[model samples]
Target chain A: MVMIPPYVPEAFLTMYLPAIYAGLIVGFIGTMAIAMKREEIHILILTDLVGLAMIFIVSAVGTDLAEALILPGLVVELAETLAISEILITREMRKIEQDPRRNLSKSSSLFPQPFSLDMEIMTTAPNFIALVLIGYGIFLTGFTGGAVAGGGIVLYALSKKARGLPVLILDGIAGVSGIAWCLWIIGFLLFFVAPQYWLLSLFLAACGLLLKVASKVGLIGLLMREDIDKE
Target chain B: MEIILIIAIALMVIGAFGIIFLKKPLDKVIMFSILDAGFVLVVVAFKYLDVAMFAALVDPLSTLVFILAIVKINEIRKNKVSGELND
Candidate 1:
């Protein structure tokens, strides 16, 4: 397997890996930090192991870690895990244990957005025929719709989070994606969408964990501050 | 071939829909973990061990993060709720 493709986007590694590493570190620190620390520690250790394995996986493959022929299963599994945990946490919080009932049953009334279907169909288009054409086009004369889409997604995310520090970070990501693609737009380029799924995915997860840490560090204060400074 | 794929597809669909319908972010995260498990299971059955392993491990870890995130976000919301109440 070709390990490192030439011209790996700077931002691809920069924005992504750091975030993942952060998550691992957080898991370690978290495992140590708990009072009910015995049983919970194993889960954190599992998280750390999984994070490390991901790093190895990314180094092995140079293509879509999220959607490689080998990737979707991981994505779906990850999604499901999140679902189950989400429920457990919801119940553990000891508030409203059940989901709120909605009077209307159809997808239409629930979402209330008139155009979600349209948006879903449109988003899938990139994964459709255009993807094949674009991939071939990039292969033939070095035209990259993938990079464009990647950058576009980042930009779209920035717009979606227009008013926060996350927006700044998102914009930074989009900017990097743009710079990464600049060559693909003009000349032959090598992309390192790594194969070490465990490694990179773990890294991303780890880094994102800082957001959790920051939240925790200030949590008590935030609670107190909320009451005192209620505006 | 068809039967297995169908099962995987069904899990993915149901899990996907279930997660979205959840009001609590934490619940959403849990449903997503289930979805991830079902998908990973399918991948293994299809003989994609490497992918399945990654799914098996990483998916649940991701859930941990999501749970943490939702907890944090919920904290923020509750803080805000209390603030609103105090006001």
Candidate 2:
């Protein structure tokens, strides 16, 4: 068996690493300085800039391992943004004596007028585009696949909302996604305890992960529909 | 260094500055998208196609989240101001 050559991490670090670092420094300082003078909302937005800088620095390593490292970073950044945004909204709602949950459940049209869903392409396109995305996501399998698949579902759901579609089966979709999550965990456990069952583990992990991601993302679409629904 | 890499770096730096200096939430989000595009291109330049694909797909969702947050915040501010005026 031919041995795969080990990747030298230093190879890329020596060339143009300084440029990447400069970007990172600028990002960090810029956000910090601006954040000092801004409100919570602006500061929250600025944090995302810091994340971009971190990505630039991390990707400068230019190796497979480094590439893999970037996934966790991205996930953490996304989670941070989501959690912070939720907290900001909830706190603000409560400050005004509004029942946050009630507001979320009842509000329609997050923006002003002309935000209407009357586009001609909304009727013609999203289906094909979402289909292609979901197909590509399946082909990519793993975390990247999940992102692509989730994106497709989100797009499809948004378009459905634009067309005035009702979201009826959200709980069912969430339940199935939970089951897929369990399967994914079992698949990982199997990899460690039953190495001989590699094929079974691989199948479970890949399929379960893909399904879990797609359905969870689809739920985002449904939830957005619920939020934006006027009825 | 390749011309593409240079351009990508420039884009990111410009975006970073724009986000910091631009006071409006909408403008910041727009600049953030520019920064995201540059980051994705840099990943592509480094030949990590998988990571780049993931970045491209997820960036929009993050931007959407930001926009939603900004809108909600603005709405809350409006309600507070109007309520104060009514009182």
Q: Which candidate is the best by TM-score?
A: 2
User: CAPRI band of model 2?
Assistant: incorrect
Q: Across residues B10-87, which tens digit of lDDT does each residue of candidate 1 receive?
A: 888878998878787767777787688779868878897755754554453345435534554555566557766775
Q: Looking at candidate 2, what is the lDDT of residue A216?
A: 73
lDDT (Cα, tens digit) per residue for candidate 2, span A166-191: 45555677778889889999999999
Cα lDDT of all candidates, in order? 0.45, 0.74
**How well does candidate 2 score on lDDT at residue A134?**
87
Model 1, span A1-107: residue lDDT tens:
43555656545654555656664665565445543355543454454445444554443333465334334444444445556555664454444333334432222
Looking at model 2, the pairs that clash are none
Residue A196, candidate 1: how far off, in angstroms? 27
What are the runs in model 2 whose C-alpha is more than 4 Å off? A1-6, A9-13, A98-115, A161-168, A228-231, B1-87
User: What DockQ results do all the predictions give, each relative to the true complex?
Assistant: 0.02, 0.15
Chain A (candidate 2) TM-score to true chain A: 0.79
